[model samples]
Target: MGLTAEKRSADWLAQGGLRPTRQRLALAGLLVGDGEDRHVTAEGLFAAASDAGEKVSLATVYNTLRAFCEAGLMSEVVVDGSKSYFDTRMDDHPHFFWEDSATLTDAPKDELKITGLPMAPDGTEIAKVDVVIRLRRK
Candidate 1:
């Protein structure tokens, strides 16, 4: 038989080296239950939890998202100084941020390329680079 959503979420969390607490299970189930990749912010996820009858606070959502990112289960995309999005798809890719709608969408990875990047600092190593193409109505 197939595993239930809760069970699957619990297993995933365990594999990610995270303890499967009640709040974690609930939030993880909501985030990854459908097996579809998604990008969401803390406020957006909190609204979703509220709509789904899950009693999760915004602060809890933020903390949980940070934990998930630290566990390598999700990726954080910062669009602006004040706005950040959590992406479920961890593979290397780019994103399109719609300014008017404040939405994020995946860009075609094969079509994007980076060149002419400056050298890293004397003692620092270059980490992964993220590209976010911003869009607005014409």
Candidate 2:
């Protein structure tokens, strides 16, 4: 069963037309091998790799994450411009950002809305809009 789940995730990446290399497969296993989604950064992923006893370079983690995002296996959320968090959920949903804890959570899709459309910049188009709602401790 464990091997089957891992293979399913690897195959999912393969179905996206991405080469499931060892590093990519290893990262994918950490990201979605379990039945739950998670928010992680490349640095966090590197830590996870260490915890799992997997040897992966930071550059490789970033590269594989970019590839996964491009292949639709993950979503990139830029809570802070300098740093970005990755989400394993591949659906159109907003995010709940806990500033104090530095965590990202899925917001109910129905609680979001968009109005007053703005014109697109020259030679650019809107692909997807990610809304991040921040929360604080009382």
Stretches of model 2 off by over 4 angstroms after superposition: 1-3, 121-124
With candidate 2 superimposed using the best TM-score fit, by how many Å does residue 42's alpha carbon deviate from the native? 0.6
Using lDDT as the measure, the top candidate is 1
In angstroms, the error of model 2 at 124 is 4.3
Worst 10 residues of 2 by lDDT: 1-10
Tens digit per residue, CA lDDT, model 1, 12-91: 79878999988898889887877778999999999988998988899999999999999999999998877999998999
For every candidate in turn, the CA RMSD to the true structure comes to 1.4, 2.1
- What would the per-residue lDDT of candidate 2 be over residues 28-105, giving only the tens digit for each residue? 888877757989989999999989999999999998899888988888999778779999888889999998988888
Instruction: Indicate the TM-score of model 1.
Output: 0.93
lDDT values for all models: 0.90, 0.86
